[model samples]
Target: MRISRRQFGTLATASAAGLMVPGLAQAQSATGMHSFAAPAPGKNTHPLLAKRDQNAILARIQGLMKRDGVGALVIVKPENVAYSTGYVSRFAYGPGVPAGSQAAAVIPASGNAQLFINLMESDDAPRMTDDVDVTAMPGFVFVDDGTPESRQERSATIDPLAGFKDALAAAQDMASDGKIGIEKGSLLAGLLAYLNSQVPEDRSLNSEDLLYEARLIKTPWEIDILRMAAQHAERMMSRVAQQLEPGMNALVLENMIRAAGWAEDKEYSMSNMAFQIGIGPYWGVSGSNRNYEIKQGDLMRIDGGGTHFGYISDITRTWAVGGSPTSKHEEIYDALYAGFLKGLELLKPGVKMSEMYAEVRAEVEKSPLLPTYARGHVGHSISLSPLLEDHPLFAPGFDVEFEPGMCVSLETSYMAAEGSYAPGPYNIEDSFVITESGYDRFTTVPDSLVWDGSLTTQ
Candidate 1:
């Protein structure tokens, strides 16, 4: 199973298993946007999507269209592309981060959803999603290669400009002479130049914030998928904990987690995995090159994650190399844990991100285990992308409020012991879904620094 790229906390607790179902009264097209009403909750509208809450989805689309000073949207980022079309991108930009990929989703304020992709997925991409119309670009195909039986996909080669002309035409139709809202941060300069060549410069703007804000709120169906994703994340984390030993290489552990996920029947479209390896203080973000070793007392922190069902899970856990966390280890964990609890306690609908950060930081500052500096949100809206996505990051003036169907990570970290990777902070993260009253957690890992000492010897 492939891991697809794919949060916590209101103190108000709800049954983690009891999903908060919302009744979407169809796509309200009163504002002249695409009106799509998802199938009733608990439905299999597509191969992977069990719920197609069109109302929830259209609400986001409407939000983006209604962004002040914006008139239309061109969603090209992998995260947003998947969000609208349910077409998880198999495209990889590599370490160099290419300027553009041959994929996009053109969403008009008052029509249908148009998903553009490489030629490779043209044949079956529509089968992977619901609602949106799929348009595969030219010159590539989604393939599995490098081996005979049960071959694995390396990646698809793309003609950077393929189908872009047609895509621009679609965007033009959506824009309908309105200011074109492009993904400025990601819709590369080349693409932008091309788009600008076609449209009036005065009629374009960066609508990243609008798209992000729209994506922040999840529908009941999306929440269910996120919940499943979190469980898969815990399984991967548990594998690392269970197989952890004094002599295994980081590569081995990486493969172990991947295998464990497949063993659990987890399948995803695109995902990446990297971890900080080596003994404490020497931690470095190492790949699975098979060189780094895990010493008896090394604190191996996995700062990176992969995807599941096109939705990435942001779960970080620092394990004591030999298990049975020492008092010193516990102290560091406690400091970070303080923020986790405070984040949860203060997390309710209408609560500001700034407020959450201030309160959580107040508690985190109480711990001597931390360094002098601290920044970032105690929690951030999560879905599709794992980092500070959906305009996440509780900085000053982030006036957004927690809303139902929103998911976030109750994230916290600290510098346990410094060395080559001086002041490397211990990473602790989990997922939660905001609901009608409280929230629903995705990961079930224990929230304490303590793990059974006996597991070290397993």
Candidate 2:
């Protein structure tokens, strides 16, 4: 387990190279498309080989299946497919691909799982993991290399419909009389019809809720990835904050945030959508605008983050534009920060989410500067989904208890009304993983409200 840095680097390089499909580069070049780059290794570890525990994940899935009386799960959603089989397909994630052409994972409660993918990804699918068997369906006709093995592979490709039927049959055989759970929302109409013809409607179940339940608890590997994601977001925000000056609009700042991600070979997941830049009276509106220029004495608010290997980071920081924050700014920020700190203190295991929300709300109300401040929720869970927030929100009436291995975000935000004192949004948010005792914070940026223009671009 104690691998030297040089050995780890070699192993990481080999793992990256192993994920390339045969003739992929040539195919990309012939089609005038850029070749996809392998995900960059984390700063301190090989994320996949060193941290990802495929066995642990599968065990958790099977345990949940048993508890739900689901004998088998047919996963068609791209995220669930990757979670089950470790095969992250580019075509599956892209919008141009037809519904039936994307990859799927069939996992039984007590046996080996199967990954059904298009023929083009056959080479890379097996390299993703040895825990599941790969079944390549008919799609993506490749030029024959004339090798015996290549010829055999091409000859073995069957009709796509037939392939789907065979996979369903295999699942039924493995499960016997047990109920089959399928991600009904992600299946194509034709595929669903075919499945209906094979399995009785009474025996079929929608697996969406079960899948979400499985993902609610973060594995150690997932926590590590989320930690790295938060670190990247903090670094990106710091870089963006340094370049903040008068006359710069929201669009320019948004692009700088994206550029920071690209510079580190990371994908900008939130991009322009979840990125909120508020100035003046537009405090509650989300997204960036080209016309909103930063002015001295304007309280600037930024709330966003990026992804690292599919896991997301959601952090918010607000500060002055070019000079010291006004007294009103200090008053509001101090109130919100107090709520944020109280939330952090209550983030330990066994605390109910609703109790935390109530406590944080009471703490914020204690501040005379904003006694009437209110919010629906202080924060929510964070994970692989691009939608950002996940289940068990820190809101009223949510009675879910905090558990170890759950990744969450805690925030204190106030969007002032137009013409109110220091009319703008004020926010302080960070990501954390609930631990055995308390929680470990992922974001490290200073929560100070003053922006003195002291930061320099890296």
| Error at 289, model 2, angstroms | 3.8
Q: Give TM per candidate.
A: 0.76, 0.78
Residue by residue across 169-255, what tens digits does model 2's lDDT show? 777977877899988776777788888988999999998888887888988888987887776666656655665667765545544
Report the lDDT tens digits of candidate 1 across residue range 273-331.
42343345544444434566766656666544555556666666677767655566667
Provide backbone clash counts, one per model.
21, 0
Residue pairs with colliding backbones in model 2 are none
- Model 2, residue 117: displacement in angstroms? 2.5
Whole-model lDDT values for every prediction: 0.61, 0.71
Q: Positional deviation of 4 in candidate 1, in angstroms?
A: 27
Best by TM-score: 2
